[model samples]
Each structure stands twice: as C-alpha cells, then as structure tokens.
Target: TLENIHELALGIELAGVRFLWALRKPAGTGNDEELLPAGFEERTRLRGLVCTGWVPQVTALAHGATGAFLTHCGWGSTIESFAFGLPLVMLPFIIDTPMIARAMAKRGIGVEVARDESDGSFDRDGVAVAVRRVMVEDEGKVFATNAKKLKDLVVDEGRQEQYIHELEDHLRRNKDV
Candidate 1:
C-alpha cells in the first residue's frame, strides 16, 4: 500500500487533483523512500506526505471527501473500495495486479498503469499518464458510476440479510444431507 500512495500521487497530480502519499516507514526495514525523480515534485505541484498505518489509511480513503481510490489492487483494498463505493485507480504491483485491473476495468472499478516489461519500471511519466487516464478520462467516470452502483448493493441491508440467511439455510441443509 505504501507503493500505492507513491504511485497514485503521481497520477493524481498529473490529473490536476489534490493528492497525498501517506506511507509507513517500516521498522528497521532500512528501505529509503524512493523519491520522485528530480523536478517531478515541483512539476506535479506535489502536496503533503504522511507516515501512517493501515487503519488510518483506510479511514482516510473511506472519508466522504475521498472521491476515488488510487490503490495497489490487493484483493482486500479492492473490496474496501467496493465497500465504500470509491472508484479505483488500480496499480497492481504483483502478477495478480494486472488480472485485478482487467477485472475491475470490466466492472468499471478502476484503471491501471501500463507496464513496460523491458525495463520493469513505471517511471514518473508513465505513472502520470495512467493517472490522468483513470482520473480525468471518460473511462474514469464510468468506473466511478459503476463503483457507486456496486456500493449501493453492498449497503442494502435487506438484500444482504436475505443473502446471508439463504446461505446459512443452504449450508444447514447440505450438512443434514
């Protein structure tokens, strides 16, 4: 998720949106923050930075002010975005990330940066381009609209309870059989 904040910040800034990249300086991990390339900070009109943990990060993302999620495409984060009805700016860092991006794209959940396999790098330019595409492009709005619809489904208590009860009954019947 730390990488997510970093990756998203670039895109958010490029899309002319206010942005932040909150990170956790892991205990004794000795990994320095891989800073944006020279001049990027100035060019992108960089905003604030924070060193925070997961709960607070999720809290931040769920806040009413949060319009979208620029995330790493972890299943947990993906679900969280869905729960909050926040459209995603997915940047999958793992092998599964591309898959998640593809699926979410289909469902109008988010967008991912294109990878350059030759260098194994997502340079600032690429990140900026992807961010704009997802945040400002028409596809981004479609993703957000779908995300809101999905969130409504999740928040419908009556539907949820019905589904849960049905699941429980089905389980009980199977156990008896």
Candidate 2:
C-alpha cells in the first residue's frame, strides 16, 4: 500500500500539472511527510497542495478551477464527480470499483490507470499517462463533454423523479416474486 502511494506521488509529480491531493496517511504513519517521496513537497510546492487531513471532497469538486477527479471509482465518488461534470482518472483497487472504472471508461467519462494483472501493481508511468490523458491531452475534451452530459442528467430533478417512479413501479410488479 505504501508502495502504491509512493508510485502515485511520483506519477502525479511526473504529470507536471497543478494538483490538489487529499492524502490520508497510512495507518500508523507518524506524519504526512513520511508518506511522500523525498523533496516531493518542495518540488511541487508551487503547483500542488497535499492535504493530509480530512478534506471537503464536495467542495473541492465544486470549485470552478478543478479540472478532473482522480478517484478509486467508488460509486459515491463516481457519482460526485459526475455531478460536478468532472472527468475521471480512475485507480480502482478493489470490490466493485474495477467494474465501475471499466464502465466509466467505456462511456468515455474516465480513464483507468493500467496495473499489473499478476500483482495489481501500477507504476508512475501509468499514473502520469492516465492523468495526462484526462487533463492535458486533446482527448480530455471528449471526457469533459461526456461528463457534462452526465452532470446534466444527474442534476435534473424531473429525470431523477422519473427514475424513482420507475423503480417503485418495478418493485411493485416484482413484489410477488
């Protein structure tokens, strides 16, 4: 896990884009500094902010300057990112997250960081490439457009109510089953 964190840090640094990283320190780690590569903070000080405490995720996502979300593709996080019209750079670790990541990638709203099938390990290059694809490359525009469409659907009260009603109807029809 520490190695993964280190690789993420290195990859984000290599991406060379402004970033806001909300890093929850590994359990039993004494300080945040202990979690990062040497001189990473100083090297990225001008373009990055690494917060080691609890962050207001929604607030960050809603900020106008925020470009894309680097997430683990949990349902909640995925929905939140979509609600804000933010493209995703996904690094799914477990459970249904990998499936969610794949679905989002298929929908063109995100890019999944590649990992080793044998060890499930990802490197700095993968991280940098995924970030750059969603943040710097021209392909990012397509992701942004798709994300905005998803956001519109997510924020539409009428559509939401329709979905709820549909779900209720389905449940009623299946109540006997």
Deviation in angstroms for 152 in model 1?
A: 0.8
Candidate 1 C-alpha error for residue 5, in Å = 8.5
Residue-by-residue lDDT tens digits, candidate 2, 105-161 = 999997999999998899999999999999999999999999999999999999999
* Model 1 global lDDT (CA atoms, 0 to 1): 0.70
Predicted candidate 1 versus true structure: per-residue lDDT over 52-140, tens digit per residue: 44446678778887777777788887877878888877667677877888898877676667666895556446677666666667777
Task: Find the 10 residues in a row with the least total lDDT in model 1.
Answer: 46-55
Candidate 2: list runs displaced more than 4 Å: 28-33
TM-scores, in order shown? Answer: 0.73, 0.95
lDDT of all predictions, in order shown? 0.70, 0.95
Q: What residue pairs are clashing in model 1?
A: none
Which portions of model 1 miss their true places by more than 4 Å? 1-15, 26-46, 52-55, 95-98, 117-120
